[model samples]
Target: MTYIWTGKRWAYLAMVIDLYARKPVGWATSLSPNSELTSNALKMAYESRGRPEGVMFHSDQGSHYTSHK
Candidate 1:
């Protein structure tokens, strides 16, 4: 949890992990998660881990990755 003091209370965080090496390449802490947070995690993962040219990325039925926005 990020403990985001949202003017009223603490908050939580949603995280994204890469199964490739069993590590969190990206994560986001927010009052709540949206597509943006997911995308940031993905971006961080790519940057931190050096985006493989054709590596396959997999995720569940999360709309964030599916939305393609």
Candidate 2:
């Protein structure tokens, strides 16, 4: 997760990168750095990747990533 100065308020961005491609496969931005922001990025990556089976995900265990929401 990272933040950007929008010249007024801060904006947060979440991204999911494909290890194989070494590039971002999904990304999302929001005004709030919360579970929803991370969820949105994961959801996009899952769907865009055809919802493959037996995939494992790793994270830095940040609160947003570990949230129940």
Candidate 3:
């Protein structure tokens, strides 16, 4: 997780990178980091990438990622 100073307060940034191209494919920013933040980024990446199959995801063992939601 990365925190950015927006001048007034800190904001969270979630990003999904296309490892093959070494570029960012999707991203989201919010005041808080939660399942929604990560999910939204992943969803955007999935849709933007044409919903490819057999993809692999890696992340830290955060509860948000482990949540059933």
Candidate 4:
């Protein structure tokens, strides 16, 4: 999770990167960092990548990632 300054206020930015391409595949912003934020970014990446199977995910061990949500 990263905090971005939007000139007026701070926002949370979540991103999914394509390691092979070293580029961002998907991203999402929210006022708060939560499961929904990361989930949405992953969802976008999944859809963009044609929904590949047997994919693995990694995270920074944040509560949002560990949460049941």
Candidate 5:
């Protein structure tokens, strides 16, 4: 899961959940949320759970989750 500052200086967080385990895996936040904000959450997921061979991640249609640029 990835969370970035929601308002006024990225002071909030978002939680990432694992569907397979139905558990809260990783969370990310920053004063200025950006690609790296979510990236860190993804990295945390892997580090804590070990590298997955074919892990599938899902998320709602959010800018951070969809923006490629």
Candidate 6:
């Protein structure tokens, strides 16, 4: 997860990468850095990859990533 300045306000970005592929498979941006942001990115990656099984996820353990929301 990261944030970028969009000229007006900061925008939060959540990304999911396929390490084996060394590329991003899904991403989402929002004004708030929260669990929903990460969830949306993960959901997109899951759906885009046809909802594969036994997949593993990794993160920096940010609050949003660890949040119960």
Which candidate number maximizes TM-score? 2
RMSD of each: 3.5, 0.7, 1.2, 1.1, 3.5, 0.9
Give the per-residue lDDT of model 4 (tens digit) for 14-35: 9999888788888899998889
lDDT for 4 in candidate 5 is 45
Arranged by lDDT with the best first, the candidates are 2, 6, 4, 3, 5, 1
Q: How well does each candidate superpose onto the true structure, as a TM-score?
A: 0.68, 0.95, 0.88, 0.88, 0.68, 0.92
Better of 2 and 3 by TM-score: 2
Query: Residue 9 deviation, candidate 6, in Å?
Result: 0.8
| Cα lDDT of model 2 by residue, 1-69, tens digit | 999999999999999999987989889999999999999999999998999999988899999999998
Looking at model 3, which ten-residue stretch has the lowest summed lDDT? Answer: 60-69
The number of the candidate with the highest lDDT is: 2
Supply candidate 4's per-residue lDDT for 38: 87
lDDT of 1 by residue, 20-64 (tens): 678777777666657776677677777887776886777776776
Pairs of colliding residues, candidate 5 = 1-16, 3-14, 5-10
Evaluate all candidate structures by whole-model CA lDDT and list the values in order. 0.68, 0.95, 0.86, 0.88, 0.70, 0.92
Q: Which has the higher lDDT value, candidate number 1 or candidate number 4?
A: 4
lDDT value, residue 26 of candidate 6: 92
Candidate 5 per-residue lDDT, tens place, 1-69, comes to: 333445654464656788878997887767655666777777788777878788877777677777674
lDDT of 3 by residue, 1-69 (tens): 578999999999888899899998888888998889888888999999999999987878687667777
lDDT of 1: 0.68
Model 4 weakest lDDT span, ten residues long: 60-69
In model 4, which residue pairs have backbone atoms overlapping below 3 Å?
A: none
